[model samples]
Target: MRVTEDGRGLQGSVAPTPPLQAVVWATGYGPAFDWIQVPVFDAAGEPRHQRGLTEAPGLAFLGLPWLHTRSSALMGGAGPDARYVVEALLKRT
Candidate 1:
């Protein structure tokens, strides 16, 4: 495989495209939940709630993007998510 730079002289590479069964992109979304009069999903393709605290009993979320910071949904933010879930659970009890 050879990688060629574009006109801008930036390094790039080209690899054979692999077949995909589905293409559910998680590119994130903008703030658009006004019309959604129900549980909403945040930028991480997960349900949006206050620190993963869902209205449903015993239901919560974690690792949602833009929750705590821009990296909340990332792998590094799982700890925070866990905390939120635990807190919510505690509140329920």
Candidate 2:
């Protein structure tokens, strides 16, 4: 289904079969690490790193677009990156 341009409701060829009781709209926007006490952002304010791996020791990132793959920001993408970061951290210890 497609959301109305005004965002009041969904606009589609067919109505929902079960009828619509509630709708949750999730939107995507740029990341804002303003509160982070780290120097990981670039001039554009995005993270300065390679595939979510920052140069800061013991610092790593996840759930970022193209972090490990094209789906890095998605649900399944965090697992592998998380594991890799964890292993690296363990090795440091």
Candidate 3:
């Protein structure tokens, strides 16, 4: 498949293909987060964080894989990271 230069449509070659009623494109690119309207992420569009803690006060993330451990994205891994974030929040309070 080829993305349109305007980044709005796709083109592909498929034999005996029916007219597309709808198309859903899934790109593995990083999150846009453009709708966030916050100064949390860096220039790269990734949340500026250290172990799920962002520079913005009272802002934190969870369930990010490898945040602090290999399992950080898993339910079990979320516990430790949650504790850490909570601890930091408490300190600020």
Candidate 4:
């Protein structure tokens, strides 16, 4: 897959958005604590997780809200987010 960004959002045109085999809206049923409009996601546009940790065993989130700090969910705070993920993984065993 060819991927490039021009810094103005998407630089070049992309092929038509393909249809999904099965669209599973990952929008979690809202967070237990509401904070914003629309489903709040981490900087990766993925679902938010607590400390990047999931309830499922061996499963974890990488970048998510409140993983380490108030701003960790934003783009520049991935460091703490990553650390949290590692911790969660280690505890899974």
Which lDDT tens digits does candidate 3 get at residues 6-89? 434444455222343222111122334554444777777777778777665555677665778998777677778888877876
Q: Could you give the candidate ranking by TM-score, starting with the highest? A: 2, 3, 1, 4
Better of 1 and 2 by lDDT: 2
Residue lDDT tens for model 4, 36-87: 2233355755555556554433444443456568766565676666665666
TM-score of 1: 0.45
TM-score of 2: 0.60
List model 1 lDDT by residue over 22-83, tens digit each. 11112234433332233445565456567666554444555557666777767776676676
lDDT of 2: 0.58
Q: Could you give the C-alpha RMSD of every candidate to the true structure, in order shown? A: 14.9, 14.2, 13.1, 12.3
Maximum-lDDT candidate: 3
Which is better, 2 or 3, measured by TM-score? Answer: 2
TM-score of each: 0.45, 0.60, 0.59, 0.39
Clashing pairs in 4: none
Which lDDT tens digits does candidate 2 get at residues 13-79?
Answer: 6652343323211113556565454566788777776655566654566777887787777776767
Candidates 2 and 4, the one with greater TM-score: 2
